[model samples]
Target: MRIHLTSVFVDDQDKALSFYTDVLGFVKKTEVPLGEDRWLTVVSPEEPEGTELLLEPSGHPAVKPYKEALVDDGIPATSFAVDDVRAEFDRLRERGVRFTQEPLEMGPVTTAVLDDTCGNLIQIAQSA
Candidate 1:
């Protein structure tokens, strides 16, 4: 079996949409309103039919502390593949995205972590 969909807990869906699309360069796939929240998801432009990334709301009580702990420990909530981690990091930094970790090479891979601006740390990686 293969992966289908995954999510990142967000504090604000609209802001997350803006960041994920306008800045991170993902394309919106679905948006169905569910009362005060929506089932919002996005996909990489290069893979329109691939796995979708859901921008789930962090309204649950446990989510707040869990997310906080992750942030406090400098851990990313999720990672996205990139052709070049350094290039992607530079491009994103130029757009004012705050990075917690600069691109670092580790054997066959390189990675950088950035704030999603909606209460999550995201990593961009390039693997050899």
Candidate 2:
């Protein structure tokens, strides 16, 4: 089966949407109100509706700890491919995005990790 969806836990849905769409440059694909919260998803501009990145709420105790543990281990919740890691990092910095790791060469690729502003770290990578 083809991969069409993935999820990242977020403390707040609205904040996550802003960071993903406004800062990280993903496009909103779907947004539906779900009682107190909402079911939100985003997709890369290039991919459009190809894949959905679900912004799941981290209100559940089990999910909150798991997400936090992943962050503490320096593992990004998700990674986005870019044409130029350095340029993308700079552009994101200008938008007030906080980065934990600056662009660094890693063998055949260059990558950087940044805070999503919603309790998750996201990675941006480019071919070397």
Candidate 3:
């Protein structure tokens, strides 16, 4: 009845791991070798047992164009909830994260979009 695992296609697993952990503050949960790729996943530090975010490889032929089109239209590959959008945006900007869209507030919700550095636009959102 609840969500379990989800994934974001990545161009490089190692780089994605670094960005997701060192930069975004997620922690590695599982890493299992699977032929040419690994079944790598990460979970929020605050929610160690929560849903896992898989760092899947973008080796499929259809993935490139799908990613490109999403980027071209300024769409996020996935969104992550944050306590405060502006604060998170500032923190991420200080770390040299490139944002396609700055924090914008709409009623009770605020959001910002940033490039994942692995071929996807990711969004950080907050709701008041």
lDDT values, one for every candidate: 0.96, 0.90, 0.98
Q: After superposition, how far is residue 38 of candidate 3 from its true place, in Å?
A: 0.2
Residue 65's lDDT in candidate 2 = 82
Candidate 1 vs 2: which has more TM-score: 1
**Each model's TM-score?**
0.98, 0.94, 0.99
Candidate 2 Cα errors over 4 Å, as ranges: none
Model 1 lDDT tens row, 57-116? 999999999999999999999999999998899899999999999999999999999999
lDDT of 3 by residue, 1-128 (tens): 99999999999999999999999999999999999999999999999999999999999999999999999999999999999999999999999999999999989999999999999999999989
The candidate with the higher lDDT, 1 or 2, is 1
RMSD list, candidates in order: 0.5, 1.1, 0.5
1-128 in candidate 2: lDDT tens per residue? 89899999989998899888987888999999999888899999998968899999988889878878988998998888899999999898998989999999989999999999888899999986
Candidate 3 residue pairs in clash (backbone atoms < 3 Å): none
| Candidate 3 wrong stretches, greater than 4 Å | none
User: Sorted by lDDT, highest first, which candidate order results?
Assistant: 3, 1, 2
TM-score of 2: 0.94
Best by lDDT: 3
